[model samples]
Target chain A: MNCEQARPLLAAYVDGELDTVRMLEMEGHLPACPACTRAVRELQQLQQSLRQESLYHPAPAALRRNVLAELSAQARPEPKPAFWSWFRLVPALSGAMVVCLAALLAVTLNRPSGHEQLTAEIVSSHIRSLMANHALDVVSTDQHTVKPWFNGRVDFAPPVKDLAAQGFPLIGGRLDYLHHRTVAALVFQRNKHIINVFLWPGSEKNSAPSLDSVRQGFNLIHWNQGGMTCWAISDLNPTELLEFTRDFAL
Target chain B: MEARERLPAFEQTVLPHLDAAHNLARWLAGNDQDAQDVVQEACLRAFKFFGGFRGDNPRAWLLAIVRNTFYTWLRQNRPAIPTVELDDAALEVADPAAAGEALQTRQADAETVRRAIAALPVEFREIIVLREMEAMSYKDIAILADLPIGTVMSRLARARKLLQKQLAREYQTGGPS
Candidate 1:
């Protein structure tokens, strides 16, 4: 076969897609034809370079968590209303149970306030950043270095401090978009666990000094100081997280 | 199948291909954020309809879903960039002289290679990514790309030739060694 016939077949030939007879014909033709030979070699080199290149990006851990979380949520069995229906049949106990149920339902259905919602957002974001293996945009242990890195990234100056002497070393900071606005997420390391402290400008003056909550297996502490709302979240024990927050707050 | 049985089957069949799915999405979507979004949506769809899956090749099946998801996303998010049919003639490497520049292409760095592949049209880009980077066979690519084997082969040829031309141009323009 000449160059024209061989030209279209070269890719298949290189890929081992050709039948044996065709492969033999192409192999025989390659030694006699320099141009076809050069094309085949070029195709091989391109394939090699492509394989060597870092082209395949693994799905980030956050994506895995998000997808798995969504799958588990979908797979979760629907709440069994049959059990509740059976509980409603006892007329004598129904009066007391109905009142108790009303109070319980009221507590369960109450929507979280803006601050509480922000706390949940903070914990999820912290988990996502860690799971995504993007824990820090600027990694440093020095307080001076971590503090200045957030300049101009957010509207307010985020307070960054080193509590390494107290066992919480400042790791770095990342710019996070939370609650429909950009906020500062300062990272600190307590032993092996990471603590994400999200800071943003406070909306209310002289708000409560501190509030603590837990959600989705994470502990969160929120506080307002000097016109900034700061939230520290981690999987670390609540006492340790609160201690770290206290040192930073002071 | 019951929901419990479906979960295990879906996990066994589809979850192992998460990286492959994300890799294709990342290349197609052109960024991490969009790639993640596309993969998430694709996984949800895969789980929802997994009961209907009859094919034996789960990786290819997942990849096909990813390809479809990416297109739908492109259509909704980027209406201006129509998914135009790429002319095979336009992608042909006319200059036979560039074939000799294979040595320079061999020296091409990862960034240069990435830029060259990124410059390809979506169809060409997807084929090359599947065949070369993902190391999928022509038949498997045919399955994922929803094309005949001949079409897959010719498109791959055209894609490689386009890459050669791009690399040659880079060398001509003094791309980093």
Candidate 2:
């Protein structure tokens, strides 16, 4: 039980992983050795700093939701030879589960991209609102009406602008959830296609250009204006969607 | 689906360890954004092969998968990370000059600790995350990291020394004027 022998075991000793014999020998050597004592102290201090750093990053809220949603989707009966006949036996809950999974499959099947998942979430919410036939809480076509409608409903005022002159007219707005908070969902229309613009509070009024993404055959454009994070999603073509954002920001 | 029963069993055993999985992934990925991706990928892999899980020490099982997912993603995305094993050949000696000054700053603040941990090469970095952060036993880390116990022990020692040196370097550069 000397310094060289005890030196290699110091880390294991500190971790309480040493066997009884090695632990006792290390204990015996440490009382006589100042060097080993210092090493032990330094290791302990490092552990303390690490633990106190708040470095334990918890699973983000969205990860939990996405995983659970995915698990439900994963829980499907094995395929029968008569696949068409098997469809009839799927309980009502499982039937809804399939649709839910299908919506996520488009996003989750891709490479693990947080940005992709977020866009998928936005598109999913938009489709859900239309599916549930609850797209707007306050159905007004005026900018004044839609803007004021969000005053008491949400913590911040969503920037609502009328863009009828640009051919993308304001339909209405509603309170919807996204990015872990209640956001302003402003519905608009370009010709026959519907557009859902989701807005939440943002720190910087980014003057940088808007970034656009296409998901599930829908066009999306995101920008930050007036301390609000805004995303406009639509079935319209990308050019029209970009134009729609430009008009709204005007 | 007959296999539908496995989902609940998987969630009960695996989902509760999400925080552990996240913490390990975050430290390995070096940022919140990539860490989320790593965790998601790990969860998928865990779900896919969960029927084989014997179910003891679920956190350790999930953590092993998380570590594997991170390395796989790292190789694919940042092939820059050396694929060869590091063991002793990669063990970096701490800055000799900062050693003395580093000792005085035993109470290195949280931000310094974070920077020090993040600065270690991925080889040393993973050891610290598993041993110090996760509080995993040496044997458990040996299994999770797929290394001999001696290798795990030596690496942990070197990793701590490197971490201390990193903290000391910070102290020397930015110590009180």
Candidate 3:
């Protein structure tokens, strides 16, 4: 790879984004070339500096507490199985249910085989929102406006608080559709950090506090607080969320 | 496996990625509280569809959920607020400390770098977080950002270039607080 050609690939090389063949080719060329080496060195320094800046600032503890509390509130109300349809006797109902059940059955029967599909859905939703520009509906710093806005749109009222005084201000509210029902999404901002709190009815059957973390790329903080489950998602480190939640109050 | 047995496995595979999800949510939401909300919402969505997760990277899946939750929240409520400058002084980079205790924290100079990163444009910053901080591959980044792999590489390169420039600017301006 010549200087001009290798220059573009330097970042990829540093990142190991190149395949083995490309990597070996770059390696062979790099030793004989000072310019590319220098360029590579500069890129490395730059990346290190950027990495240095990757310090995470977590969501405030109170926000987690408040969100969890709000979720727990609605969680106590178990979802009554869609009023056992008299339609169950109808052939059409049975047929439709059969199809849905088949799909569900296939999934349930092969839980381990569906990890990729599940991840894709999660990623798909994330990309969809960014491209679609429907990230938030209610835009306000007042919790009052955010909390009440969801009254009719969603079945449960999400706990909303304005943390403006504490540096994270309440932005408006919006209705989100998830788990087969409308849920409340309360928005907040901390510097450049945006917290999206989704409140919905939790399963009364599984009320244990649960937590999960993934490191494929972004960091996720998912925990069930009280009866309400809260997932604090961000690229920020878990420690930051811990700090944020520590200081967060409803 | 029974739904009962499968539930724990789902939790085991996906739950470990919650912090990663939370971090992504925090960056997208631009605040701790909003990030929490996004993470919570994403978790529910993730849980409901846990059965659909096949053999794939769970963290990216969860992050994808966070990203979706953030945008969904934005659409239904407010537009994404651009990360504003908190006056140069408040963000002024603290000087490298001379003493022992402060030196330890100052060694990496991570805090200042973080603030500088926070100040970047969302388009640029998101890629940076996904690639460098989170260490996602080009393909995964493409999937996450809905961009092509070429675009991901170029964007990540550009993001790095911008970070270097920002660091240089910080150095020239006497560092951030």
Badly placed stretches (over 4 Å) of model 2 are A78-250, B83-101
Clashing pairs in 1: none
Q: DockQ for the candidate 2 complex?
A: 0.35
| Stretches > 4 Å off in candidate 1 | A79-250, B102-107
* Poorest stretch of ten by lDDT in candidate 2 chain A: A203-212
Q: How accurate locally, in lDDT, is each candidate?
A: 0.84, 0.82, 0.63
**A44: Cα error in model 2, Å:** 0.7
Error (Å) of candidate 3 at residue A219 is 94
TM-score: model 1, chain A = 0.53
- Looking at candidate 2 chain B, the ten consecutive residues that score lowest on lDDT are B95-104
| Candidate 2 vs 3: which has more DockQ | 2
Higher TM-score: candidate 1 or 3? 1
Tens-digit lDDT string for candidate 1 (A160-223): 8999999999888899988989999999999899999888898555444354777888888878
Per-prediction RMSD in angstroms?
33.0, 30.7, 41.2
For model 3, report DockQ: 0.11
Ranked candidates, highest DockQ first? 2, 1, 3
Worst 10 residues of 3 chain B by lDDT: B96-105
